[model samples]
Target: MRAIWKGAVSFGLVNVPVRLFSATENHDVQFRQVHEKDGGRIRYQRVCSIDGEEVPYSDIAKGYETSDGRMVILTDEDMKSLPSRSSKEISIEKFVPSEQIDPLLFDKSYYLEPEKSSVKPYVLLRDALEKADRMALVTVAIRTRMTLAVLRVREGVIVLQTLLWADEVRQPDFGVLDEDTHATKKELAMASSLVDSLAGDYEPDEFEDDYSEAVEALVESKIEGGEVKAPEAAPEEETEVVDLLAALQRSVDAAKAAKRGGGTKDEAEATPEKKKPAKKATKAKKKAS
Candidate 1:
């Protein structure tokens, strides 16, 4: 893949020439708006609201609304006059433990490849961060905005993940939630046990976008001249009202059974089968041969 940006990663006098490549790809099918009756491609027009006439691109200019219902027009040169740093550097500000960062703050990831001459410093930084269990908090400008990012090692390669600023996140106000109700100790304990039983290693490959898969299947069927039938939706399970203690007990039992079922299946698959040793050569078989 082509590099999205060519820049140097700078920290404490160390500048490593690196190229940034997008780590993720979008596989979603895209659709365009079209005229349904004529099957013609839809086109958008730039029109002046006041004049009710289509305007050319040259007539467009950026404007901001003021409190007095007036617009302040800004020219391209005026925007260019604003002080901004070039999007050519990944400037490291500090190092922090990766665990301290909230997963929600991360937005996107990009792979960092070192220039041939800068491989030494790249590997040095990657190894140092891996050993220290820390990630470098850096800032880099992409497009026209500067974004906070985390630089860390992933599978022996440096990866830069963009992060949202702390201020960008809204504070959670639990005051809106009903506080008069309380959970019993037994109920809480059972819930915790159920969570523990279900806990396992995170494997992204194990999950899939089921909705997208179904949509693709439908599309493929239509393309192949096969009749696509609407699938019958499963009936929703009704919620049962039961005593809190009984519900908790049932949950615990269900969790245990599920865990045992999974363990049995896993063990059966993992166990090695005993192969019957080849039968001793019979004198009659040798004579027939």
Candidate 2:
């Protein structure tokens, strides 16, 4: 991948020259807006709203409308006047425990590779961060905008993860959480037991995006068959909801069964659904009596 930015990480007297590359990539299939009949790509042109005239790119200028309906035009020089510290350097502010930083503040991650001459200093800083178990708080300017970022050790390399500003994180003032909704001890205990039964280390590889895979498979089948086919019908089941205690017991049993090479933990819980229709039969017998 091409490097997005080149800069030096400065801490104390050490300067680590490095190039930044984005850590994540999008794998989504892209589509375009097109004419439905001819499959021609749709296009848009810039035009002046007031004069109703086609405007050239050179005529465009950034403008903000005031509350009084006045247009305030800003030029390139106005933007250049803004302070940008991360243009060519990443200055470390302070080191804090990795846990101290909230995960929500993280925006984007980039991989940092040291220049040939700065390898020693880079290794020194990387090792120090690894050993101290701390992440360096830093501010960087990308694309003329100042951004909060963290300098951390990832595997054997240093990673720069951009963070959101304090003002960017909105405070939760919604009254829903303030309302009192209590759970009984028995219910909480049963829920905890249910959770324990299903508890296991999170391995991301164990999960798959089934929906995406199904869509891709459908597309492939359509390509091979040269026509669309009706989807296979799924079993129709009633939404049977059992009582609290009964549901908990059934769930616990199902979890045990699943751990013992049976199907998912929901199997035993579903057996209670058979009782729903039986209740209707009892009501019919009562009416006949």
Candidate 3:
């Protein structure tokens, strides 16, 4: 795995240089938005709501909407002025019982690999944590933001799991839960017996994602049966626009050529010539002779 970040874990005077790698990934079937009729890929544009015009990326700025329907545009300089951490040190704050951390508060997880020279110190910390049955709560700066995380051992490797802030977790409030409710003894006994009968060790390998498997099978069968549509052709409007521009250009060039040659052939043929009055007198003299 590629290391996403290079940082050192600092606890007191002990600093172990390590590389951080993401420990989990998603493997779900992916899809794209497309036109159902012609299989054309769907596209979207960033449009300004007030002007109803598409906005370019360079012109975009972060805007914060106020509760009173006002917008505050923030520039890049303004964003940089905000307080953030850019340290490469994962400073250990303190160690606490691993059970104290609520599973719901956990966010992203990363695996820490020790540097070649720091292996001894890294192993010492990992072994100490395992023996104490504790997790080191630490503050790590990732992407210029500082967040709380915990360091724990998993299969002899130290894993860093980020945690959500306490305020971020919502309190569960429901009217049904507040109402007084109790299961009868007989019903409770039957439920307990049912749970006992179904209780077994959880083996992740035993579970199968039937839905994703079925989707893959369906797509493969369609391909094998030749059930597919050709990609949509380009729109004809662009070609028409190009032809119009080319015709206008040709007309301009023809006009320029005619102006340089004095006039057009049609114009010269339509012009009237000066009439000679002696033509009639010449014809009469010839007849008298």
Top TM-score prediction, candidate number:
3
Q: Per-residue alpha-carbon lDDT of model 2 for 9-107, expressed as tens digits?
A: 998888889999999997675557766655555667688999999776668899989999999999999977867654788889999999999999999
lDDT of each: 0.83, 0.85, 0.91
Q: Least lDDT summed over 10 consecutive residues: which range in candidate 1?
A: 271-280
Angstrom error of the Cα, residue 250, model 1: value is 87
lDDT pick, better of 2 and 3? 3
What residue runs in model 2 are displaced by over 4 Å at the alpha carbon? 67-70, 225-289
Candidates ranked by lDDT: 3, 2, 1
Q: How much is the lDDT of residue 277 in candidate 3? A: 46
**Best by the lDDT measure:** 3
lDDT of 3 by residue, 39-139 (tens): 88787878999899988666889999999989999999999999899999999999999899999999999999999999999999999999999999999
Clashes of 1: 0
Model 2 residue 65 lDDT score: 98
Report the lDDT tens digits of candidate 1 across residue range 126-197: 999999899999999987678899999888999999998999888888985757887899999999999999
